[model samples]
Target: MNLPEFATTRTLNNCPAPAKLNLFLHVTGRRPDGYHLLQTVFQLVDFSDLLHFEVRADGQVRRTTEIPGVPQESDLIVRAARLLQNAIHDRTGAAAPGADIAIEKNLPMGGGLGGGSSDAATTLMALNHLWQGGLSREELMVLGLQLGADVPFFLFGRNAFAEGIGESLQKLDTPGLWFVIIQPGVTIPTALIFSSSELTRSTKPVKMTDFSIASKKLFGKNDLEPVAARQFPEVADAIKWLGKHGDARMTGSGACVFCGFTQEEQADEVLKLVPNRWKAWKAKAMQEHPLAGLLDR
Candidate 1:
């Protein structure tokens, strides 16, 4: 397989595309364009899906597996690669050979872990190097944002404070703390959350420092939680269970619930106490994205 001079010299071939958790999500309003306005902090976690690339002669981007519920063509990874190719071709007068991208899915789908967006970000970043496009990281991030609001943050690839549909990003120096993530096995359609009449449409913006400290209270509930809990009782049950461990809160929209703690041991203690019926994991928050370490080299 052909690779960049730097990548060719390295032994490791795979890139780590990490997942994100919305430390807390607030639906502030809806735009006239039908997009939801949001304010939330995107926290990168050690948990991730592995993406392996093999350069191909043909310029066709494809995924190994159909992402369970998402259509192949509509998948973010494909769209992102196509977007990058278009952007680079338009600006640089050339395009890179498309690679067959394979993803080892570990993160749960529809759980709001940003798996799809992360995968898309990996596609753009990896191809930018693997194809030898020589695009600046900032330039790639700009192209990524057009793929999805979450895409830019994943491209930034770190702990970030985000607002305005989650495209706006501000990097933060959050310590590597531990988290307990619970998935209740129910898929809460994102559209349902946004379309719900009960969804909050107005929330005053809070300062970053003030927001970080206030997040400890978990007082500002996820606006979509109520509609989700009504549709899926198991989600509420998972939240109730994790709440016993710490200040349990829902991530984007619904379904997955998380609680942050100071130590892995404490998170493990809570993990053991959880009922065997629900799926859960204990992961440390990442100061930098797992993929950043790969790219930096």
Candidate 2:
């Protein structure tokens, strides 16, 4: 029999990569590099994708399993391992470290919840330890950034208030509220939304101190929502339905919509009211990533 997760999830060979919700996403501006500058808050959720790593002695990074549509070379997990391997080789001239990575995915792709970025982050953290790379969080984060903008924040390992293309992070004291995240069973194309002429590129920047302790709960809004909603009716439907229970917003450039509740029972009640056609899950916010201390914070 397979041992339950909380009981055995942190074993030597298996590691957890938690999912995240963008409590709010603001497109502050666009960089000359063609990347969009963003101001957002990243909240860790209990929902996660678990990775099981088997180290390869001969220095070959590989994935033992397949993610239905993603090819092996293109998987973020694979890319992360290779990126670290190359960086470690350059840094210390040590034996190139490698692993056969396997995934237990729970987070949905294109749901705007940072599944791919978290997977890549976990690969860097896990392989860094298993292969004895000995790189600090500082080193790992640089390699993480090459994988994706969001990768570095997962390596930051906290609920953060982010800015500057999502890398500049300041830890936030946000509440760990219960979340009712409803997946509208649609895959949102982030690129499509970003390129649309309808997207508002300017949302006045807010100081972190602008919100009082009591007002923090009311401050989240996704600037991408209206654009996404216009393209995907399912997204609009989810936002409208979830908003009935609590203030709801799209997480990231989302196809998934979520609302917060102070009580688990309150979230559970709203979760029950979700239309049967949609997929949904109840999760609690995580103050820190599960693999947080694998490397120094």
Candidate 3:
């Protein structure tokens, strides 16, 4: 793939696309447009996907590899590059920004881990720097919002208490925790869960300041759990099994369920107990997004 270029041979590598967990997701209401209103805490995890970019001279933005079940044109990585490219040309009348982007996809698709959104956010940040796009961090975030709701939060660069369909956010200095996340070897479609009649759309929202490490038990429930659990028995089983270990919650609209541990060894121990039928990962919580420093620049 070639991108409109002004003659540079720079390559950006090892840019990280981290995953996120909704420590708790609450659906408080539904908009006339059919979007669900949400309140939740988003925590970054050490687990991540990596993306590498190489400048192209032909002015074509493309993904170097084809993703299964995802068309190249529709890949968030490709779309994000195009969006930034368009923004650049619109801003400077420069040729379309172009690059051949290769993503190391580590996060599970449809696991509700914000993998795609994080990947998109990283693309925006990486390309902005690669092309000297001059768009500020906040500007790229606004641009990311057009790609997906979770995109802005990833760009926000910190753990956040989010609301209003999750575009609104307030940073949180959440206590670190280790997690044993189990995927039921199934994918939970977000749209299906959101539209399910079983989904609870009325949970009293809480103040961000009201959240405390001491009171974690109070905010541990995800309003979408019932729907996902009902639709996927594996989710129910995973949740039930993990609950014996600690406070188990479904992160976002997921088939992936997780339990938190105060120690890495504790999480590792539980990871060993995860049934062979499911996929388990031991991850440590992060205070900020892996690309948090990029936002400051």
Model 1 segments more than 4 A misplaced: 1-12, 214-219, 293-297
Model 2, 202-247: lDDT tens digits are: 8889877664344447584799999999899999999998888878
**lDDT for residue 139 in candidate 3, whole number 0-100:** 85
Kindly give the stretch of ten consecutive residues in candidate 2 with the minimal lDDT sum. 1-10
TM-scores of all candidate predictions against the true structure: 0.91, 0.94, 0.94
Cα lDDT computed for each candidate against the true fold: 0.77, 0.85, 0.84
- Model 1 accuracy (lDDT, Cα): 0.77
lDDT of 3 by residue, 111-196 (tens): 98999999999899888877888888788888999998899998888889899988998888777788899888998888898888
lDDT of 1 by residue, 188-226 (tens): 778888888877788776668876666545445577777
Instruction: Give the CA lDDT, 0 to 100, for residue 70 in model 2.
Output: 92
Q: Please identify which of the two predictions, 1 or 2, would achieve the higher lDDT against the true structure.
A: 2
RMSD of each: 3.3, 2.8, 3.8
Task: TM-score for candidate 3, please give it.
Answer: 0.94
Error of 1 at 181 (Å): 0.5
